[model samples]
Target chain A: MDNQYIEEAYKEGFTVRFAVKKRLFSEQSEFQKVEIVESTHHGKMLFNDGAAMVSERDEAIYHEMIAHVPLLVHPNPQKVLVIGGGDGGTAREVLRHDSVKECVMVEIDSSVVEGSREFIPKTSCVFTNPRLRLTIGDGVAFMAETKEKFDVILVDSTDPVGPAQPLFGPEFYGNVFRCLNDNGIVVAQGETPFYEPEAQRSLVGIMGKFFAVVRPYNFTNMTYPGGLWSFIFASKGLDPIRDVRVGAEQKLGDFFYYNPDIHRASFSLPTFMRKNLSGLLRDK
Target chain B: MDNQYIEEAYKEGFTVRFAVKKRLFSEQSEFQKVEIVESTHHGKMLFNDGAAMVSERDEAIYHEMIAHVPLLVHPNPQKVLVIGGGDGGTAREVLRHDSVKECVMVEIDSSVVEGSREFIPKTSCVFTNPRLRLTIGDGVAFMAETKEKFDVILVDSTDPVGPAQPLFGPEFYGNVFRCLNDNGIVVAQGETPFYEPEAQRSLVGIMGKFFAVVRPYNFTNMTYPGGLWSFIFASKGLDPIRDVRVGAEQKLGDFFYYNPDIHRASFSLPTFMRKNLSGLLRDK
Candidate 1:
């Protein structure tokens, strides 16, 4: 009688909601929650360990856009680092590049990594790859001490809250710059352009001061709170947009997230976003 | 602590969820319900009358993208018909065109119109304009009997559900084709490409059969379930993409939503979307 109550079980607890209109998936161990009345495309997921709101059903968009942007720009990226992406989605994408010999994922929350491995099998595939090294530590602190420099560093932190807030600050960015090679590139998940214009602008402004080429790219993810989200790539040298190259022979079959065409399309910004960037740059 | 329970209010013994996220309104009325969350951006609102979720701040993006696309494409859009948009946001945009001499809106529910006018004042401004005419009737039925042709027809209906299901059917599109003059364009709120790829394909396929030119456009509305939502535009004669023209002199001051640059940019679909469109068209 009560449509609101869901008997679904998640990693944290029983997935109980007053109402769940659209259930994309409901199995014994996993479920996806799409709010009947309002939702972004990818429904919120209830896994055995934790819950994550799917910003997009096709994770290729976010994973490819985030990882490839910086990876392509930094030529000869042998050593790469991913921060806060315990789900291993970013690391999975990072491993796609044959040029990369080593990848280290530093996620603060071990539970998220464990949960992702158990529930989100698509993302968990990254861990099974021999090239990836998983580290349970604060990314900010990890970057501070690591003398071993990476050619590319990806801060795939959650929304600017909890452990992710410091990642947005200038100090963390400076550390990221220090921990990277001279030609290294760093990319972070910037918030939605529609909702957090100020935050986006500020982050861009801060990164511009620290990096030579600070470019922001737009991607659409439905599962996130807002329909449109952005990611900012700050590099010491090359332009991500200009230097991007996808090999014809490279394994495109394994990729559900990134491709050559999307590589170009993701960089296109709407008028408001372009205006915000111009205004933010002008203020600098 | 319990964020799950949605309080229902009985209005004349009619049970309704107290949805209240309207920014134009200062006071919390009985007809509105508001949801508060740990959102980095503007708070979300769901208007009860139209069963529409309107973010307190970002309704402009949805309204502007929907209204301006078709309006700008038709060179001399004088008579406009908006179906199922009780919120009056699309009408507000339709009235913005100086070339539009008359704008008629047919809404199925009079309560939605009244509630929007009371709570969403900015959107309701269109109704007060001298060129606007409001009609409460079944839009499909009205289209059938009326010989009056429109330069632009904006199908601003809810998701294909409840009363709006008829709007997505073949008969309704046939009526739309008849109601439009030569060179007339129609814009409908298609669902998200990620979540509702089939819905978009269906609409595009149906509209493509009736119209010479059919294209799908996207906008980022954070309040919507998916971060990115798609809208399909079908023109009887003109190409929605190539036909767009906004004269420099006609350009108004500071539009937060739609502009000439964005007009071109919105059509630039990602690889996934492009593939979807191509596949759909090839199948046809």
Candidate 2:
């Protein structure tokens, strides 16, 4: 523990610096560089390939949003699959639903999971859930070959670089389309709309080729670039708004970010995003 | 300016650094230190007392949300008052409506007005508009003495420190309540809920005593502390949603952030915000 700082350059000239009290863990994992540090403001922070992956203070904002939005929308999410969520935060939210009988998580890097278990137990505590079947392998390959059907698939991958690059490709989405049931839904971490619109539009364009419903929703992430981050929701035919279960959101206990009102409001895109993401948004 | 960087520490341990291309203008105004610099990512940025005020790239997100939300709610806003917006961005949006016959802006520091006009024309261009009447004076004093009534009043002051401290007090809001018409609406810059919840709760508590409807809405700001900022909307009787004029948003030429969908969506609070701001929020 010492006076150390970690800076993330969001763009060419904009950077966010965090005062780290100590470096808890640092490793060159098989997939990417995984580092965990205890920071002053955000407690435990995780970085994958130098990109901020999770923080203790604001982890629920991303994890609850990614898990609850899709799980609440699905009629009966009895079975769920999470890809690339080595942190176990997504599975923790997924198993909160009593209707979920089984959950499977596939992570490419074991170091991320091990690091989370030791340092970020707030999210990694889901490892002991009896319903979860943890798999250590590549998610893209798993999606391409699995014959099992899932009611919901949460693609909690990193940014579209390094090992996560294949997860954003057309072939991976095509495989994801085949693994889901008829009323199944898939939600992925779309890039920040303000900073990475071109990549977001491109990813939505690829998703549009296979799914009948594609929509992007946004939330405020404190550590991310632009403070605004988006998630791409692709479904076979379910509309997130019209098909929302009446009392579904109430069953989930309490949350930091995700709420019934936020579920609908997150889809209300700004004018600039609507113009920039035109033709790519299937709901529009 | 060659290899310069300006860092803003939001909290004790978190900071956002911007690479400065050149210093456009820097002056010690009577109230605070005003500086305008050409930044690499945000184009030209204005900083008031080392805090990010406005940037050329994302100025519309803050300006549009403040002005349009109140203006569109009032049925006919012929007279508008802007307090502490020396940058002219709020007045520019206020005068965009043809119904506004006059707009009076009172800013304490004259140097902020002059510096903005010379360096940041995109927001300061409203100085030449014939409908705007610029005055150099203290807004807190003007609100207590002026007998003139306005349909909409925008309190676009800086953070609750230095000269802007009185603007967040109960006496000022009491004066503002008396100086407004029956159905008048007043919207002021509420601090970020995530980082400054105590201030946000206290301000909302003050406004609740003066107005019948007091609600706080949030938006995403790139350079702000938590990337999420809030505004307090207080009205005598008019509701922002129920009393919204039909087809009024279409009258707006074009916007980067404000829209009919966004107007409604911005008021939805996340779970944590709702819990922390329970008794203070009038709508909840």
Candidate 3:
């Protein structure tokens, strides 16, 4: 196998390389440098500033967990908001629900969506769906100004080290809290506890202040940094484990990961993570 | 960074590379190639047959989860048997319990143990523990021929791809059933479910025949192929989740990953995994 393009992903003191068969597209987006590369093994992959975002092969794991988990918890989510999921995989998953009438995705950069359509055409088709409202602006500003409330808010941002750092902050969460309905649920793709311990601990702590019930869920994402990725869900009325609607899996279409059993199981954090987040949760 | 050794581990479809600072020891054991190399970030690392066995940095996560989960489930495990944990980490964790009087370790390769003592001294200190009786012999033969019955039987072998394949077979499971007491529990280091789905499903199916309770638990191991790894517990009298001893975490020393909450949570398989395993469990 003669591979030309190679992206070296450095995380948690190790280097993992994904061999790209061909570079499909590259652009200096306003938010970051967005690149889409075709790979032999992982299929078409989208990278933001040299970091992996979504791949055609395993993006379903990330997308399904982020979208369906919070969706299933809320009884009837009519309106939903997605922050920073430019590749449209998050929006695709959100629209799968029969009750969700409107899904507004606020992506900072338009080039990522453009690249996704041009290179990774399969998952990107949802961007053109009439039910999806694609907004090209700052998610923070959109959440603050828009009076339209959502039943669920999904943050599909990148890692917190760079431009997506603000998305994980309390202010952003506060804005999300305001934009959501009174009994709404919000979930973000939290970084892995194994790789980013402090970040994961702090994120749960920040969300606990604004919401009555804040819980973090985990899933196995092979393309991600440590393969153990998490999504932090904070709800006003619904408990993620208790409020999950029975027979929700029946309404959902061909999913690679998310199910009712997985929804309940995701909240069972390891001892180290429970120790890291419990004190933070109890501080309030 | 000037490095002497670099190992590229290929698993599933991804490649992870670890940089080694120095080679501490090397020997061709009768069973496999035993090599201990000092890594810059991971501390001392052990490799068997060009595959990672354990690393000093995160060996606690693997060792603790493997040994303590089954140990805590059983009320009072007096006699324990370890099959193929040559690194001595399993022996160290089993001896932590005050109730366990003896832990017998049977490793086929003496050179693996010899290399561990010479290189990874911290985790390998249990080789000298008085309660542990080390036996260097074929584990399969020992289980078949020996009349000794153990309260807890732990299989801590390598990947099921090569020499370790036989250890996961139905015949070996039969030997384990014969060597265990009437109310005994057997736990094996099952392969990563995320990487090897068929193998994991088959192992569960095979174990279902011999044991009334066969459940798989998961943990995150950074150095492993997939960060998520599994340990399958097969028992005759005790249910891993229902019979887990309370205050088990307090009884043990400071642990990096395993705990009572995690012990219960680990059995909560992912949706795809539950779908894979439930079918196998339902077969019997």
Candidate 4:
């Protein structure tokens, strides 16, 4: 086939390219202007009115793994708080659990939610759920004002930048600690184990300060640049993995995503990761 | 950006589009052509040139999990046969064990071996080792011709289609059972647990008919369409996970992939998978 024909195939977006480039989504309505002009080791940043909706390539694995792990860990988890899942994939999975009562999604960008609802329908199903309470504002600010503690809190924000940078800081984690019930657990996409070891180290370090128990886990996803990503689980007064109790006896549905076996397997670290996390342990 | 501008981003030659109208490569080359046109529910395939390196996406996890589980199970493993690993990543990991003396790799595509050596350099390093012997031909035919038995035989094929379809069938598995020395083991990549349950069930069913022990395992990789994937390990004599041992006494190296702790963890099934795999197992 000629280059022109190949070019046509590429333009159709039938085959999603795992490449790095600047992405720009112009604002059509009364929202922020979306322009993504930064390059990372992973795929291109996807900006909606100046905030990341999801990275073009690495979004699914991060969104799926982060949402599924905590939901599987907690038995009969009802009330949930999604701090910054503007894309709504996490919220979609959270509502899949029959036991979930209400999911309060605090997205900083109203434009991201709106754009994603139109562009990415697979993720946007969360908004259609009657149980979801969508609030368009600062996630950190919303958490501070709301005393309604949740059984599970998911911090599904982008990398600590612009509005999200505060979400990774010590104060945000402390507030997340305050916003969770006694049996509550929190899982967040930490960073790439290869590219951003320092970011993972710092986030886990701060999480250790606020939560009595913190655990780091790894999952392999190819769309991501380095092929491996990590997530950190922080709980106020419970050991995240220890608290999990799914067995052969438990009745579970057909899940394409998460389970108890994977719950334990996710915590198994490679030697390179073990070396990086040598002295850090959150066993307070 | 104009349509012409957006078209420029698409790269030809390596891209695989799903729609029938958008296939780039149609003519069969000297290498094989494996087309996943219509599975029960997985993605509809355009044609794939067999000349292209066909690798199980999670090469590290699949290679390490298959080799280590059986080798660790046996008291001493001195011989191994790796079927259909042209890239040599599997052989590289098998060489890590000090107990093994001879390892044979049978791959049909010599170009894939040469191309992977030139392109994917890290995996290609295994080809240079003196302990490893490379055979270029059909693995099933080679296995039937040999009177030589192996301590462990690893069937590392691409997805079950084209040249590899027969590898998952009962006839080839019966040969694999005979090729193994008494108390020897075999492991192969089972299809995705989420997307292709029939493929998983069929392969597991075939292995169960031929071997005394058959078990399915899973690992999550993000780069693939769905997050989780499954692999099955079948042994003629011993339980691979039960007999394996790794502890503080063992000296480990810089492995970015598998470890002993993960060996046991990998065997643990999630509730959803457990439900799907129910009543599939037969008495030994």
Question: Fnat of candidate 1, please?
Answer: 0.36
- What tens digits encode model 2's per-residue C-alpha lDDT throughout B1-284? 12588767777588888899898998998889999999988988888988999989999999999999999999999999999999999999999999999999999999899989999999999999999999999999999999999999999989998999999999999999998998899999998878888888889999999888998899998888879999999999888888888788788799998898999999999888888789776642
lDDT tens per residue, model 2, A193-260: 88888889988999999999999999998898789899999999999888888778787887898888
Ranking by DockQ: 2, 3, 1, 4
Q: Residue by residue across B144-221, what tens digits does model 3's lDDT show?
A: 898998999999989886667788898999999998887799989988777788888889889889998888888877
- Model 3 DockQ, alpha carbons vs. true complex: 0.59
What is candidate 3's CA lDDT for residue B37? 87
Q: Taking the candidates one at a time, how many backbone clashes does each contain?
A: 26, 0, 0, 8
The Cα local distance difference test for each model comes to 0.69, 0.91, 0.83, 0.67
Best-fitting candidate, measured by DockQ? 2
| Residue runs of model 1 more than 4 Å from their true location after superposition | A1-58, A72-76, A246-251, A254-262, A270-278, A281-284, B1-50, B246-250, B270-278, B281-284
What is the C-alpha lDDT profile of model 4 across A1-284, one tens digit per residue? 33111111222223333232333344644434553323333333455433334553445556657876777667768999998887787898777777889999998887777667765566776788999999998988887788798999998877665667888888888888888888889988787775577888889888888778788977655343334568898876666576665562144444543566666777877655667776776754
Model 3 agreement with the true structure over A1-284: per-residue lDDT tens digits = 23554565565457666776788888997678888888868889988887889888778888988988888879999999999998889999999998989999898889998999888877898978999999988887887788888999999999996678888898888888887888899998889887788999889888887888888888877677667788998888688877888897686767777777677777777767777777655211
The DockQ-derived docking category for candidate 4 is incorrect
DockQ list for all candidates = 0.25, 0.85, 0.59, 0.19
**Residue-wise lDDT of candidate 4 within B96-156, one digit each (tens)?**
8887899999988776676566545556788889999999899989887889889889888
Among all windows of 10 consecutive residues in model 3 chain A, the one with the lowest summed lDDT is: A1-10
TM-score order, best first, reads 2, 3, 1, 4
**TM-score of every model?**
0.80, 0.98, 0.94, 0.74
Write one digit per residue (lDDT tens) for candidate 1, span B1-284. 23432222211111222222233332233323323322123333444423335544677888888888888888989999999887788898888888899999998876667656765676777788989999988888998888999999999887776667788888889989988998888999987776567778888888887887777887776455445788888887777666777473156455676767566667667667776777444211
Q: Which candidate comes out best when scored by lDDT?
A: 2
